[model samples]
Target: MCGIAVIISGVRINLSSLLPDFLSPCPELQQVDYFSIDELKAALRRRGPDSFGTKKLILHSENEGRVLLSRFHHDEVDTSAQSSSSLTPDYETSLSNQVNRFGVPNSIGELLFFGATLQLRGLNPISQPLVDSFGNLLVFNGEIFGGIHVDCDSNDTEVLMGSLEKCCSCTSLEACHCGGEGNMSVPELLSAIKGPWAVIYWQNNSRTLWFGRDAFGRRSLLVHWPNAFDSRFLLSSVAPTSLMDKNSDLDIRDGMNNLNFWEELSCGIYSITMNAPKADGYLAGEVKRLDWANSTLKELVKWERTLIVPKPEMQVFKEYSLHSNGMLPELGPQQFSASMPAQMVLSALRESMKRRTIVSKRCQQPVPVAVLFSGGLDSMILAALLNESLYPSYEIDLINVSFDNQFAPDRISAKAGVKELSRIAPLRRWNLVEIDASLSELTSEIKRVTSLINPAETYMDLNIGMALWLAAAGDGWLCRECNNDDDDCERIKFKSAARILLVGSGADEQCAGYGRHRTKYREGSWLKLNEEMKLDMHRIWKRNLGRDDRCISDNGKEARFPFLDEDVIRTLLGFPLWEIAELNQPSGTGDKKILREVARLLGLYEAAVQPKRAIQFGSRIARESNRKNFGSNRAANQASAGSVVIHKPST
Candidate 1:
C-alpha cells in the first residue's frame, strides 16, 4: 500500500549521492525529474498520492548519524489535506525531554532516523513512522487482517506497535515472562499476527534496528550497503533506477554495470545494533574505529520450517513442524478425519473471502472491488462467492483482458463463464469489460511492463508481467461501449474504480493444479507429489507473487489472495495426498480434486468441472508476444535485463 526508504550511517552524508534514478522505466513519470530526497518522494508519489509527510530523528551517538522518514497518500477523497505536523515527532524537538529521563549528555554525537508512509485507504488513513510511548519508532508497509486482537477502529500499524511495545516492555522486566521464555526475541513477536507486511522498527532503548518482510515476502524491500566495510546503509520499497540522468547513454550503461551495489533483502527478521563509537567514547579512553562489530548484523530468523518425523503413536503418523522464525508457534501433529476436511476447507474459504471483501474494515465504501477473471475454476469460484454474498450492496466487475486473438481458448471460456454467471446470480450490475490488445501496441506495452518489474528478466516473468499489466490497464464496464464514439470520453480505468483486487493466485499451488504435479504423482506416487507440492508452496514467494506485486500494485490496487490465507493453507496442507489429487484416476480427473469438490459444495457445477490452464497460455499472451518472431528462443531474451538472485527462505 506504500513505499518506504531509509538511510542509516555513522557519518554525515550528502543525501543527493545516496539516491539516484534507480526506478524501473515508467513512461508517465519520465518527464518528472528528481534529485534530492524530496524529488525521490515525488518520483514515488504514484504509489501513494493522497497526502505527504516527512520526519527526521537524531540518534544519541558520538558522530553525526541520522534517520529520515517520509511518505505520501493515494486517498482520492482529500488530496488537498496537508498538515505541517509529522506523524513521527522531530527527534530534535523531543530530545530535551528525553535527555532528562536517559541522563545522556547533549555532547554525544546524534544518530538520525528518517521514514515515510504512503496512505492508500481513503477517508481514514493510518498515520505512519509511528512513535510509541516508549520512544520506539515503527514504519510499516502492508495490512494486518482483522482476525487479530486489535481494535477494528484503530489502524493496524498502531495496534501492531502497541503489541510490540507490550512485548518489549515485558521482556525488559526482571520478574516478567512472556511466552514462557525469559526474554522474548524480536522474531517471537511475529507469531502474534498474520498478514502481508514489510517493517522497519527501531528500539530506542537498545539502539537496535529490527527489519524484515512477511513469512511470504508479498511486499518488496531492497537494501544497499554500498560497501560491507562501511557502516552506511539504505533501504527502499522500490528498486532504484539504473541511470542517474536520462540523457546520458554512457551513464545508463555504467548504472547497469553497477547493479551489483544493491540487493533485495531476504524475507524474515534481522537485527542490527545501530550504536557506533562516539566522541564521548573516545573521551572516556575508548579507541574509535571505522569497522563495526561482526555481531552487528545477525540473521534472527528465516521463513521456513524444520520437520521432525516422530515415533508413531498407535496407528497415526505424527510430525512436528518447527519454524526458524520464533514468531510462529510450534505445530502439533496433523490429524486426519474422513468428514472434517471438506467442512474445514469451506469454512476457511468463506472466512478468507470475507476478510478479503466488504467485511474488512479497510473498505471505506460499498463500491465493488474488481476481479482478474479468466473464467477458469479458480476465478469463477471467486466470482460466484462474491456475487451471491455481496452483490446488491456492491457492484461486481469481472474484467477479462486478452491479447488481440478472438479464437484464444481463454477468450472463449471467459465468454461462456460470464454468460453463465449472468444467468445464475444476476446482480444490480454484472459488468464485464473485455479488452483486446494488438501486436502493434504490444512492443510499447511490453517495455512498460518490463519497466515496472525491473530485475525480473526472464521468459516466464515477461509473460506474467504483460498479462497482468494489460488486465490492470482497463477502466470500468460503463465505458466499454462508449469509447468508440467519443475520443475524449475517458475510460474509468482499473485504478479509479477498485482499490482492492480479489485474485485466485495461490489456489493452483495449494491444490496441485499444475501438469507437473500430475506427472509427479503418475511416476512416484504420493511421496513425490507431496514433495513437489511443498517446494512449490515455498517457492511461491520467488515466482509469480513477487513480480505480480510489482506489476499489480503499480496501478494503485492491492491484490489479495484468498487461497493463501493462513487457515486455508493449513487446511490444505493437512489433507492426505488422495484428497488433493486422485492419483489412480486418469490425469484430467485427478488434478485439483479438493478444489473441485469445494466448487460443487458452492453449487458451481460447471466451474467444478473446468480444466486447469496457466494464465499466460490461457490468455494467449505468450503466443501473441512471440507471434512476430516465431520460434525465437527465450534464453536470448533473458539478456533484456540482468538477473537478480531470488532468495529462498531457509531453515
Candidate 2:
C-alpha cells in the first residue's frame, strides 16, 4: 500500500499561524497550523518509501463547467531510508476570512493531492496523483487483484486509473461506458475490483469527487468531513500523526464532537457532488452513498447474509454429535473423520493466498513470502498453504516476535510449527526469524508506534501495534540450525526480504476462534455464536485491519489476509455452524475447529491442537503495558481487558 491524501477547498486554510493562547471557543477557524501539507507528507512518509509526488490542481467554476486552471506535478526518487526527499507543495492559494463572510476562511476552488509510493508492480515506478486523457485524476493506495483484468505484470494504479477515465458521463455514478457491460459507474467499477484498496477520484467533467475503501476496509482512509469552521474537505490514507492533540479544546472543530475529530471512513464507494453555489463553502460537496450491486443485501449490515444457506452436503463429519446435555459425544480424535468443509476452506484459502502473494514484483530473492507465524492453527495453516502455492526453491520466512527474550508462547509454538512444516515439505526452507525486543526498546519508540495506531486507543491496541510494527520491519535473529533447538544454536541478525506477508485475519471471526465466541455459544448456543461472529467480521476492519495495514505498510511490506478474501468469506458462510466448528468440544480442537482440521490435513498435527494466542499476549508484550498509561493493568483488565482508552497525542 502507498500513502495518499487529498485536500479540497477554494481558499487555502493557513494552518501555520501559532495562537498565543486558547482564547477563542471556535478554534477550527483558528489555523491550519497543525496538519499542513508538509506535515501530512511527513506523517505518511514511512508508508511509501520509493517516490514522493505532489499535485496541485486549480479548479475554476465556469459556464461550461469546473475548468482546470493549472496542473503541476513534482516527482522525486527518494533514496533515503525514511524517504525524506521533499517536493515543494504549491497549494498556496490565498487564505481569507471569506469562508465566514461568503460561506468561512478556506482553500475552496484549489484541490491538492500528495502521494508517496511503495512501488509493488511494473519494471518502472509510477508517480501518482495520476491523471488521464480526460483530466480525471486518481490517488490510489491499493492493489488491483481481481475485479477488472490487470495483467500479472501490469501496474495496478495506472491500470485502475485508465479504467476510471473511461467513465465519461459518471458525474453521478448512474451512467458510464467503461469497466461495465453497457454502462458502469464508480461504485460498479470499484465493487468489481477485488483486493484491498482506498481511492480518491476527481471526476473533472462532473465536478464530482469519488472516494471509498474496499467493502472489507482492508486499507486505512481517514476522513475529516467539512464543517462550518473549516471549509476544507480532507481524505487521508494516514491518521497516524497529523494535527495537534485532537482532544485539546484548541483542536476541536466547531460542530463535530471532540471525541471523533477524524473517522475511519466506512467501507464502500461514496461521491461528493461539487456543483453547488459558491456560498455553500464547506457545504458544497453533497455526499451520497452508492449501493452495492446486490440491492437485497443491506448495505449497512452486510454481514447478515440471508442468501448463504448452509450446505449440509459439504460437511463430511457425521459422528461427533452434540448430546442434549450440550456435550460432544465421547470419541477419539480419529473418529471425527475427514471433512469436506475443511477441504473447502483449504482450497479457498490456497487460492486467496495465491492471489495475494503471486503477483508482479521488483525482485526475486530466495524468499518472497513470509507468514506472521505464531505456530498456532491459523498461522501454521497459512504457512502450510503458502508452501503449496509457492515454489520449493523459494524460502519462506516465519517472523515470530517475543518481548520476553524468546520464551513467549508464540516463539515456542513458532518453532514447533516450523518442525511440522519441515515434516510436510522437507525441501522447503523455513526461516523462523526471532524478533526479540526489550521494554526499553518499546518505550523508546512508544510515541511513534502509538501514532501509527491512532484512532485505536487501548493497551491491547498499542501492544499489538508495536509487535506488528517491529515484526513487519522483519529485523530479527535467524537460527542457522533451522531453529530445532532454542539454546546451543548459532544465530545471526536477519531481516526478512519478502515484500508480502500473509496473515490469518478473518479466520477467527468466521470459524469461532475467539474466547468470546465460545462464551457467546455457551451463553446462547449456536444462534448467539453466529451473531457474535458476524458482528466481529463486520467490525474487524475498523478495530483491527486499518491499524494492522498502517503498521505493516509503514515497513514497506504488504500484509495479506487470505481468510479475509471475499470468496473465502462466502465459502465459510456456506458451511453449517457444526461444520465450521464443533464448539461443544474442547479448546484446542473446538475453537476454530475448521481451521484446526485444515491444519491436520496439512500434517500439522502439533499445531492443529495448539490453542489461540493473540499477538500481544503470545509475545508477552502485554506484560505491564498498561502501567504507563493507566494506573495498572488491573483497572483495564477488570473493566474491559482490551478497551481502556489510552490518552496521548494527535493519532
Candidate 3:
C-alpha cells in the first residue's frame, strides 16, 4: 500500500498549497489555509508510513516543434531566483522546505512526483517513486495479487514495474511515437492483474504518462483538471481539493460547490503524451482511454461494469434459461433451478481471501491482520476465511467500533461472531477490540473526517466515514485484555498494531444483499432486481470505494477487500440472476443466497443466515449523528440520511 501523487504544471506554482486538504483545520479536511510542501508530504506520509520520496521533471519547449524533458535534482541554491510566494503565504509557489527548486519554472512544464511506501510486500522495503535505468518512472499504490507471475521473495511493486517496463517497446524517449503493440501493451498488462491499484507510470521513451485506478476503482485516485484556478494537472492517491489558482473551478472560501475541489478520476487506463504541444503549460496530447483486453468494459459514465458484473447480453440470458443439475439446486428455494454458481463463487471468494490475507506482516506484531469487523455476514465470512488462510500462531484483531457504546447492532453481533470464530479456530487467538466513542469524540474529528470523505457529503456519508475511520484506527481495549473472567479486571487500552485491514465491501454490492434489491424484485421482477444490482456494482467505485479508501487509509493501514478481487467478481458474474440470489424469500435467507451456501460450505451456520447491515446503522453512528447534526433522527430519516451536506465553514 502507498500514497502516490503527480503534478504537471505549465507555470511554476507554489508546491506548498497543492494539498491544502492536508492542512488539518477545516471541518474534516475541507476549509483550510494552504499547507507547506513539507506538510503536504506529511499528509501523504500517513498512507505510506515506511518511506517517502519525490521527483521533479522539467519540460522545456524546443524550437523544432517538440519538447525537451530533463530530470531535475538540485542540491545547490539558485542565487538569482527569488521565491514565488510573497502574498498571503503565497498559497501558490511557496515551499519553504525546497527553497529554490520550485522557485523558477524555467521549462515548458514541471512534472513533479511524490510517493510514500507502506512496505507490505517483498523481502525488504523498496523506496519509491521507483525509477529504472532507462529513466521510466513509477509510483504505484496497490498490490499484484496475480495476473503476471510474482515470486514470493519479490516485492509486487518491483515485479509490476518490471512487467510494465517489458511492455515499453519504444526505442528512444527523443523520437517515440506509437502505442504499445502486442499482447503486453499497457492496457492489457493492467487489465490482466487480479487486484486493486491506482498507478502513475512515466514512460521515458514514449515521453508519455499513464495513470488511473484499476477497472473497479478499488483504490482511490483524485484528478484536478487544469482549470481557471491554475494551469495545472495532477493525480493523488488521497487529496481533498486541488487548491487551484485564484480563478480555479472550485470556490474553496465559501465551500458551497466543494465537490469541485477534487473528483474521483474515472476507473480505466489513461495516457497523456508529455511531449505533445503544450496546452496551457501542460501536455497538449489528448488523454486516451485504452480499452481493456476483456473487450466487455467501456467508459464507466455509461454505467456497464462488465469487468465485475454480469454481461447484459441476450445470448447470456438465453444460456441461463436451461437449468443444469449442478449441486446448487439443494441450496436454493426451488428443488430444480438455474445452475447455481455456488461452487465457483465459493472457490473464487476463497482464493480472493487467500490472495489478500496471505501477505507479509508489518509493525513487528505476531498478529498482523485486522478486520473492520461488524461481525455481520460479510465480516464474519471474511474472519472465517482468514482463519483458514493464516497460520495458527498468528492472532487476528476484530476491530468493532460503536458510537452507541455497548449495544449497537454491530457491537452485539461482533461479540457473538467472535465466540463462533473461537469455537471454530480454537488454537487461534482473536482479539475482539471494542472501540466505543461518544458524541464529543465525533465532534472533535468532524473537520478531519469530513474532509477525508469530501465529495460525499450528507449526514449519512459522515456517519459511515466516521464509523470506518474509527474502526480502521483499531484503538480500544481488548475484550480479554486482562485474560480473566472477572468483570472488574482493569482493561488495558491498546491499539491493534496490525497494518493491514480486510474489509468486506463488495459482498453486499455483488450479492442482492440490500433491502432495495428485494423491493426492486417485487416491483419489476428479475429484470428490476438485476438492473438494481448492476447499478450498485457500477457506482460502488464512485459512491463508496473512494470515500472508504480515504477514510481507511487515513489510519496508516491498507484496507483490502477480498470480495472485490477481479476473479471473485468474474466468478460471481458467471452465475445467472437466479443463482446469485432468491430475493423472493425473506431478508436474510434469500438475499445473497449463493454466498450463504459459501458460508455453509465453510461450516458457518448462523453467519450464513445473517442479514445485511450498513456500517453507519450497524455501528449506530447514524442515530447519534442524526441526533447531533439534525437535532432529531426524524428529520434525517424524513429526508434521506444522506441528503444534508455539512454547513460550509467560514473562510
Candidate 4:
C-alpha cells in the first residue's frame, strides 16, 4: 500500500523537473537546479505516510535511475539504520493522526525503490527494494497470498521472490542473461500467484529492467517519457500530471493534452534493454507475453519482447485470461454439479477467506479489518462469510462510502442490510461505518484521482472513478461523538477503523451479474455470454482494479478480493450454464443465481436476491455528479452529454 517511482534517462536532465512537479506548488523554473527527492516523496505521501525515502543508482555512465519508497504512516518504520533505543511513532496511536516524514533518498546501489508496507511483518530486514542474493532488485507493490502449503512466517513478497528465483534456476542476478538458460520465465512465475501487485524487477547482470502488473493489474505503474519521441522514462504509482513541469510532454496550462506523453503500463509482462536504438528514437525490441497455454520457463533467451507503450487516448487491452494462462493453477478436469453450484461456491469462498486472513509474521495483536460493503448480494455474501469466521479478535467494519444525492439508495440499502445481518450474526462485531460526502467536496477528489485513473474517456468511467475516489478518500464517517438521544445531534462524520478492506469484485463477472448477460441469455447467446464473462474478468485488471488500487491505496489501506481468488474462479468456471444464467428465467433471478443461492445459505435472504446495480447507480453518485455537472437540465442534455444508458431486462 505505497507509491513506487522509477526514472531512467540516458541524459542528465534536471532531476527535480525530470518528472511533472505535481506534488505541490514549485519555485520558479530557473530558481532550482535539482528537484528535491522529498518533494517527489511528498507528492506520494498519501500512499506511504509512515515512512518515505528515495534511492538512486547509476545504471550506465550517462543513464541515471532513481527509486522512491514510502510506507504507510500507520506502520512502524524500520529503524535498523537508526538507533535501536530510539522511540518511533506507535502504529495504534498514529492511526488517526498519520503524518508524513520526508528525508533524503537512502543512497543504495544502482537502484532506488520507494513504497510502503501495511503489514507489520514487513518492518524487518527484507523491507522493500529488496535485492536478492542474486542481485535481482525488486520493488514490489501488493500482497502475494500463501495458499495451503506455504510457511506462515515468510513474507508474501519474500516468499514470492524466492519462488521466482527457484523456478527460474537463476542462482545469481548474473545468471539471468538474455540468452542464459533458466528453469522458468517471468510469465511462469507470475502465473503461479493469486494476489494483486505492480512490480519493477531490475536484472543487475543483464542491466535490463522488467516491469508488469499482476494478472488483475490491481496496482498501477504510470510511465511518462518527457519527449514521447525519446527513451527517457519516469514511472510512478501516482499520476505524473499533478503539477506542470517545463520538461513535461503535456500542456498543463491549457489542460487539453496533459496525458498525451503519459501512459499506464498494461497488464502483461514487458522488458526494456539498455542497448542503443537503431532506427526510431524509441527503444527497440518486441514486448513478449507468456504463451500461458504453451510456454514453459526453461526456454530462457534474453527477453526480446518490445514494450507496448500505449498512447493516452487508446483503450487498454482486456485479455487477462487467468485460466488460459497459468495465473491460476490447473484444476481437476471434472465437471461440477449443475444443482450444487452454491455448495461449491461456498466451499471455494470459505477457503479464500481463510487464506486471505493469515496473520502477518510480526502481527501479535488483532487489527481492525473492513469490507467494501454495498449491501448487495456480492458484498453481503462476503460479509456473511467473514462474520461466520473464527477470527473474532478483529473488529470487522462495514465501510459503505456514498455521496449526497437525490436519493441515497446505497446508503439506505446498506443500513437495512447491516441491520438485518447484525440480528442474524449476533456473535460477530460488524460495525457499520457510513462515509458520505458532498458532491462539491468529491469533485476535487475526483480531479485528484483522475491523475491516477487518467481522464475518464466516457461519463460512465468518470462516475465510477468519482465513486471510487470518495470511497478511497477516507474523508467521511458516522459521527459517533454525537448524542444518539438528541434528534439534532451530529449523527454522521468521517473516520475509519480498518486498514484492510475486503471486496467482492470478481463475483459479478464470474456469475453473469451484468445486464448484458441477461440479454445474451434471452437471445440464446450462451457462447457470447461466456465470452463476455471472460472479457469482464480480463478487463477488470485495467478498467476496475488499477483505478481502484490507486484510489484506495492512497489512504495506505490495502484492498483484498476474496471473489477474485484462484480457487473461487476455478469453481465458478466449472459451473454449467444453468448456474450462471437460466435461459428462460428473469434477468435478476437467472443472473448470479448460484451466488444468490449461496447468499440464502448464509441467511442473507434479502441481499441474496437483490438485483444487480452498478456502483455508480446504486450509490446514486452518478446521478449527483450529473446534477452537479449539468445542473437542472441534466435529463435534456443526456443525449449530448453521453449519459450512461441503463438497461432493464424483463423479469
Candidate 5:
C-alpha cells in the first residue's frame, strides 16, 4: 500500500545530505532539520496518505553515524480513523492487550511480534512482530492469511519490541534475534504460512539481518550489495534497476559488488545476491550466492504437498456484510443458493459488475477506465454492465482491438455484432481499432519478447503486445474478458491497463459454462460433481486469476475480477450445471442463449445476443496472419504449409 526504501552501510555515513533529494519526488518524507536521531526518526514516516509510521536506527561509527529508515502504509483503513492519540500507548501492557484483541495465533507469536507495527489507517497491525524469549526486530510485507499468530495485546510497535526481546535470548550474541529454535527459523516460518510475504529481521544485540519471501513468489523483493565502496545493502518492492552508482565502475573480487539480482519466472523463493567478480576477471569466481543456509528443497516440497482442500457446494451469498473483525467477508457455502444454472449465470454476472465499480470517492474528476471489448460474450457482458452502472458517470471508455486476418473465423460477423451492440448502447462512446499486422511480423516480435521456449510463452507475448498497443492508444483503465474456466497458463500471462483491471473470471465456473462441466453432467456423475466441486473449482480459479494480478501488478497496474464477487458466486452456486449450459448454447445463429435471456430481462438483450467467441479466436490474436496459417488440424495442413485457409464467415 505504501512505498519503502532502505540503505544500510558498513561504515558510518551521513544520510541527511541525500535525504532532501530523495524526498523531493517522494511525498512521504517528513521534516528533519537536525542531525539528532530523534529528528531523523520524526522525518521517516510511512508513504501511504491514508496511513503512516516510522522507525529509525543509528549505528555508531568512528566518524559520522550510519542510519536506517523504515516506513509503512495501512491501506485497508479509513483516513478519518487514523489518529496519533490512538497509536501512543503505555509500553508495559501493550503487547498482551494487542495479542488478545487481534487474536494472534499461538504458533506465530514469536515471528509476528518482532515485525508488528501499528497501521494508522486501519488501526490494525501493518506488520507482524518478530519476537523471541528475549528481544528481536522483525519487518515483514505481504499477508500470511491462515498462518502463525503474534500477541496483539498492545499496539503493533509494542508487540514487535516484545518479540525482539524473546528472539535475542537463543541465537549467537551478535545474531541472537534470529532465535535458536527450529520453528522460529526463516525456512520454518515460511513453510507454515499459506500466502505471499517478504520479511526482514534484525537482532539489536547481534547486528545481523535475515531476509525471506513467500514460496509462491507472489511478491517481489530486490537487493543490492556493493563490495567496493561501502558494502551497503538495499531492499524494496521495486526492482533494482537503478541501484548502481552512475559514475563508479570499480570491480570487486568477490563478484558480489555492483550487481542486480532477480529470480527466474518459475522458481519459488529463489534468493540471489549481487557480489564482486574474481581478481582474474575471467568469470571464474562466485558473482552471487543463493541464501540456502536456512533452506532445504526437501522440506519445501513436503510442506507444499499439503495443499488446502476446497469447500463443498456454493455458499449462500451475503450482501454488503463485513466480517466481525471488519475484514472483507470470505466467500463460504452460506453465501450461495441452489437454483437453475441459467439463473445463477445471470446473478453472478450482475454481482461481478457491482464489485468492479467499487472505487474510492476521492478523485476530483471521474476516473477514466477502459474495457477491452471484442464481439464476444464476456467482453460484451462487461460492457453492458458498465453502460448502466456508476462506471459510465466515471467517464468509462470501451476499446475493441482487432485484426483483419482473413484466416480468422467469423471475423466480419464478429465486427458486425460489436457494431450492433454499440448502437444498442448509443449513449456510450466506443472505439473500434483494427490492424493488419502480418503473422510473420508478430512471430518475430514474439520471439524477441518471449524467447519462445513453449506454446504458453508465445501466447503470453501476444497478450503483452496487445496490452502495449492499448496502453499506447489511451491512459484510461483497460480490461479484457477473462473467465475462471479459461486455461491457467493463459491467465498467468494476461495483462492490461488501468490501476484495476476487471475480468469476468469466476462467472463461467459458478454457472457451468465449461465443456468439461457438460461432459461430467452427461456422464451422470452429478452427485460426485455436486459435493464440493464448486468450491474446489473456485479455489483453482482464484489461484489462476491471482497470477494475472501478480504479472500485471509487477508493472504497477492492479487487476479487479468482478466475477469473483461473493454475490455473483453465490447466485451461480444455486443452479444446476445442465440448465446453465442450455442457456449458454447458441440459439440458431444467435449468441450465448442463457446470457441473452438474462440480458433481455435486464433490458440488454441486443447487447447480450452476440455469439460467444473466445477473445483469442475472435480477435485472431492466436492465429498467424498469413494465408499459410492453418487450424489445429495439422494433418490436413500438410499439403498447404504456406497457403491460408480462412474459416467460413458466420451469417
Candidate 6:
C-alpha cells in the first residue's frame, strides 16, 4: 500500500522547498505529502514499514511538461536488510522467473518494478507502466488480481523490454520498418487483465493522458482541476489540500475551492482534461479520454461471471456425491431431501471454514487480520471460523463498533453476541473495542470525509471508522460480513483505509436461508423454490460485480467473499433445501441451526451459532431515518408550495 502523486505542469514549478512539508508525518494530512514524492514514500513506509523506494523522471514533450513520481512498498525485499544494489541481474532474473512461473510476460527495467510487485499476493502496489514504444506512460492504483500474466520464462517488464528490444533491433536493420514486434499498446494490455483497477495512462506522442477506474470502483482515485490561481489537475488517494494556497483568489463558497469537494465526489479514474484541437479533436482525444467503451456495465458483468463462477472440472461436491452413488440423492429438480441433522451440517461448515482460512493465511502481512465484528450471525460465524482454523498461526482481532441511540432494540443481544464470541474464542486472542457515537454524529462525520450520502448512512460511517481504527493498530486487512444481496453488499465502504475486506456472501442463497426460499417452501412449491434459488444466485453474481463490488472499489478496498468461493457454493448447492430451511429457522432459543451445526462440526459451533440478525438491524440504524426528519421540514415545503400556488391566504 502506498500514496502517489505526479505534476505535469505547463511550466516548471519549484517543488524542492515543498518536498519536506509533503513528506512530514502529519495526522491532519493522513501522513501523505502533497509536494514531495519522497515524503509520500516515507509515509507509505509506515504502512508497509518493511521496504520502500521512490522514483522520479522528467519527460520533455513538445506539447506538455511532465514530471512523473512514484513510491513503492514491498515486504519481501527488506529495505533495512538490503541496499539498492540488491535489485541486480541475478535478483531481477529470479524475480523474473517467479513472474514467468505465474504465466506472465517478461518486461524489464521499469516494467520489472511494476510487474514484480503484482505477483505478491494480497498487496496493492501502486505503479505506472510506461512504454516508449507506444509513446505511452501509464500509472495504476488498486490490484489487478489475476488479470495480467506472463510465461515463467518471462515477466511483464521483460515482455515490454523484449518488445522494445525487437523494435530497436529491427529499426537498426531496416530504417523503414514500422514499430510492431516491440510495441504493445496500453489498451491491448489492459484488456487482458481480469480484476479491479484504476489506471492513468498517458500517450506522450499524442500529448494526452487517459484515466479509468475498474468497472466496480475498488480504489478511490479523485481528479481535481482547480480553477483557482491557475487551472491545474491533481490526483490523490485522499483529497489534495496543498493545492489550495491562501493567496489564490478562488472562492471557497463555490465548493470547488474547498478540498472537501473532491472527497465528496469520489469519481474513480475519470479523465478531467483532454487537450485536443477542435478540428482534429477525435484523433488526439481518442487515446487520452476515459475509455468506458471496453468497460460497459454489461461487459464487466460477463468478465465477472467468467472469473467467479467455477468450472465443471472443479466441482468437488459432484464428484463426492457421484462416489457416494445413488445413496446420495442427485442434486436436481426431483431430488429434494429432508433436513440433515445439525451435526452433519456442522461438519460441512467446518470443512468450508478450514478451506477459507487456509487461503487467507497466504497473505504476506505478519499480524493476524482483524474482523469488523457486529455481533451478527454472518460476522460471528466468520470470527468462529478464524478462531478454530487460523488462531494459532495468525492472531485474530475483533473490532466491535456499535451506536448507542434510541434506534437500538437488540443492544443487549449485540453485547451478548460479542461476549459469546470472546468466550468461544478466548479473549487473549480476540481484542474487542466498543465505540459510543450518536447516529447523527456518525452521519455528519461520514459526510465530512466522503461527501457522498452513505447509502447505509451512519452505519456505513461506523464501519469505515472501525476500519481506520484497525489500520491504526497495524492491521491492513479487515474482514466484513456482507451477504451476496445488493442491500447487504451496499453497506461496505471500500474507500476505508483497510486494503482487503473478507465478506461472507452467497452462504444464505446456497443454503436456502433466504426469505424467498421459505416463502416457496411454505407454499409447497419445491420446483419454484429451486428456480428462485438459482435466480437468487444469479442475482448475487450480478449484484456483487455490478453494484456492490464497484461501490467497495470506489473506497479502495478489495472485497473477498469466501462464501462465494466456487468450491463452497458448488457444495452448498447440492444440499437439500428442506435441510437449509430448517437450519435458518429464526428460533429465539439458539443460532441458525444448520449453520451452527456446521460450525460445531468444525469445532466452531460457538462462533457460527448466532441469532440471525441483519447487519443494519444489528447496528441499530433506523430503517426509517430517511423519513424521520420529514415532518420537521413539512412547514417549509408547504410554504414553498403555497408560494407557487399564486393565491392569497383565505384569512
Counted clashes in each candidate structure: 29, 16, 10, 30, 73, 40
Q: What's the TM-score of every candidate structure?
A: 0.72, 0.85, 0.83, 0.73, 0.44, 0.48
Could you tell me the lDDT of residue 576 within candidate 2? Answer: 61
lDDT of each: 0.55, 0.72, 0.70, 0.56, 0.37, 0.38
Ranking by lDDT: 2, 3, 4, 1, 6, 5
Choose 2 or 6, whichever is better by TM-score: 2
lDDT for model 2 comes to 0.72
Comparing 4 and 5 by lDDT, which wins? 4
Model 4 regions more than 4 Å off: 11-40, 61-112, 120-126, 146-150, 163-185, 225-230, 241-256, 276-339, 361-367, 405-407, 455-457, 473-475, 479-494, 633-637, 640-651
lDDT of 6 by residue, 1-651 (tens): 222333332221222232333221111111112334333233223233223332222222122212232222122233441133433221211112212222322111121122112222332322334344544444444443333553422333334333322222111122324465554344434444434455554444434344555443433444443233332244443332223333123235534434333422232323222332222111111112223333443343332221122235335345535533254545752453333434444445556555434433235543334455665566666767667666465555554434443135344444455567656655434443333344455443333232221121233342443333332233222224432112323232222223444555565665565555667656755556666666666555323322333233233334445555433443444444444445224542222345655555545444455555544445443232222332333543444321221121123
Q: Write one digit per residue (lDDT tens) for candidate 4, span 308-392.
A: 2222322211221221234333334243233455776898899888766766656553444577877888888888887766476
Q: lDDT by residue for model 5 over 371-477, one digit each (tens)?
A: 55554566566766766655444554444444444334434543554556556676554433333344555533433222111111224333434433432233322
Which is superior by TM-score, 2 or 3? 2
What's the distance in Å from true for residue 515, model 4?
Answer: 1.7
lDDT of 2 at 623: 68
True-structure lDDT of candidate 3: 0.70
> Model 2: per-residue lDDT, tens digit, 263-315?
68888788765543343333234566776653522332366533222334323
Which parts of model 1 have CA positions greater than 4 angstroms off?
A: 11-43, 63-123, 169-185, 228-232, 242-262, 278-340, 359-366, 388-391, 442-445, 476-496, 583-588, 628-651
Error of 4 at 491 (Å): 2.7
Which predicted model would earn the best lDDT? 2
Could you tell which candidate, 2 or 5, scores higher by lDDT? 2
Give stretches of model 3 more than 4 Å off.
11-36, 64-67, 74-107, 169-183, 240-256, 276-283, 296-340, 361-363, 481-490, 649-651
